[model samples]
Target: MLKFSILKCLPVLAVCALLAACVGPQKQTAGYDYTAFKSAKPRSILVLPPLNETVDVNATNGMLSQMTMPLAESGYYVLPVAEVAETFRQNGISLPVEMQATSPKKLREIFGADAVLYTKVTQYGSVYRVVDSSTVVTATAKLVSLGTGDVLWQGGASANGKELGNVDFGSGSIIGMMVQAAVKQVAHSLADKSQEVAGLTSQRLLSAGQPNGLLYGPHSPKYGSD
Candidate 1:
């Protein structure tokens, strides 16, 4: 009887093992093609003034200021942002829309950059709910070959501030928590915390060492090896 019971469970065990095998981890593919990137071997990058799709007018400059460090650290020479902006202004392309409308060939001709980084800010600043506020900044960036106007790579990232969701308030009462939230709001308003968040977002988008991130440029030590 014992032997028969053990034999009866063998088919069920085999089926479970087969099902597990079928559900195993799937392989992932690198989404973007790097052939052009490798061939171009771009050494200098021009970062454009961000197109601000958010209600916050400051988002454009805030996000723009954060892009240079990450890209430069990624082993590419970045043009002085002030000089670039001023040049655009002198050329009567003051608005981001106007600047973007200018042809990539023209930009390369003027700045002599091998590639350009275009960024868009989709979200910036805080959203107030009935209970609390959540501050978030979201942005997308793309690297385009100035020579060919082909987008070699692109990515996006977001950063969020604390949210007061089902809060215990600890030793403080509801009123105290409200006051604290209000103080935080005031601090953020004065300090423009969105800029800090934008820095984080830029780093995530431009950092070269990450998986699926930009390949090392010719200036980088890992250039061809990457």
Candidate 2:
């Protein structure tokens, strides 16, 4: 009788375990949502150096430069980096290579950037506990319309990787090493987000202008309008 009773309880326990797995913490998508800004053709965009809220020197600029290249190569309307730099000089706003934060929307108005990209590393950490080992970071981006103060589309993403102890770690688990890895992970996620912004920015320009969507894309006169 006891054997039969044990068999009956085993199935119940198995069912509960399967349900828990289904509801486990979700993996990061690190993708953008394109519903906000109207979908239109790709337009000119200013590449602002991201703000490194973390205590890493030149990390923000590095990440911004790395992230911007892929978008520019995609045939997207990446504002010329040199021209943007010139615009800053023209406007008396010096680049804070040491520690600087550029306003995407404001720059849009100054240099005619139809859309502005604002990226920042919000958080990062690393730990190898008895239970788990991991590193993570969070970044938020907002694409604002140059004309109105309205935000066209906004999104954020995060990433993490299995952490290795100081000994087993290839670079050793030094604080600097960990932070670099975390920041890199965050930068990768932000790149994914930039692509989404590029696609949506193109789309929104179409949406807001040609109610029927744009054929000439960014060239549409209705782009960057009220």
Candidate 3:
């Protein structure tokens, strides 16, 4: 009887394994084309204010402020963001849309940048459910050559509080779960949890060594290795 029962469960076990494989993360078979990015060989990068597509008012500056360090660590000279924003303001182009709209030729003329990085914040902030609250940040970026006006590279990244080890607010009782979620939401908002996630997202999006990420720039010791 035991042997028969084990043999009967084999098909069920195989079906469960098949279901798990179906829902697992898919791997990319085709890699990104790096022809344009490699040919550009840009050294100086100009990061523009990020265009915000979400309801969060802080998304633009939050994402923009987190971008520089990763690019610098990747071996590119990232122009100071504060000075860049001020320059836009002085030129009467205070809106991110306007800043992004400025022609590549004009940007090169003004900043002498070899490349420009334009970013859009698609999601930023906390979402509350009855038993859970999560803070997430998501953004996409494009690197364009100033001289040729060709997009050299493009990628996106997203991060969440739970991924950073944020504790879950779920509870045994429904009422307790709701209360914990509410408190967690309030704390997350007060602490600006999304901004912390943004920093991690920026690192993943802009770091050079990442798969299909920006290639190492001239200043890096491993330059030309990529």
Show pairs that collide, candidate 3: none
lDDT digits (tens) for residues 1-226 of candidate 2: 9999999999999999988776663322333334445552336666666666765444454455555544443334777766776777777776443213545445555777676666675544442343334444446666666655466665555544332122233454567666655655455454433333323333332233233222223444433552
Model 3 misplaced regions, further than 4 Å? 1-29
Worst 10 residues of 1 by lDDT: 162-171
The candidate that wins on TM-score is 3
Q: Which residue window of length 10 is worst by lDDT in model 2?
A: 206-215
**Model 3: per-residue Cα lDDT over 1-226, one tens digit each:** 9999999999999999998787663433346778999999999999999999999999998888899999999999999988998888999989999999999999999999999999999999998887878898999999999999999999999998888888765557988888888888888999888888999999999999888899999999989998
Collision pairs in model 1: none
Best to worst by TM-score, what's the order? 3, 1, 2
Give candidate 1's root-mean-square deviation (CA, Å): 6.0
lDDT of each: 0.81, 0.51, 0.92
Q: Candidate 1 lDDT, tens digit per residue, 198-222? A: 8888888887877778887767787
Candidate 2: which pairs clash?
38-203, 38-204, 39-203, 39-204, 40-202, 40-203, 40-204, 40-206
Clashes of 3: 0
Which candidate, 2 or 3, has the higher lDDT? 3
- Model 1 regions lying over 4 Å from their true place: 1-31, 162-183
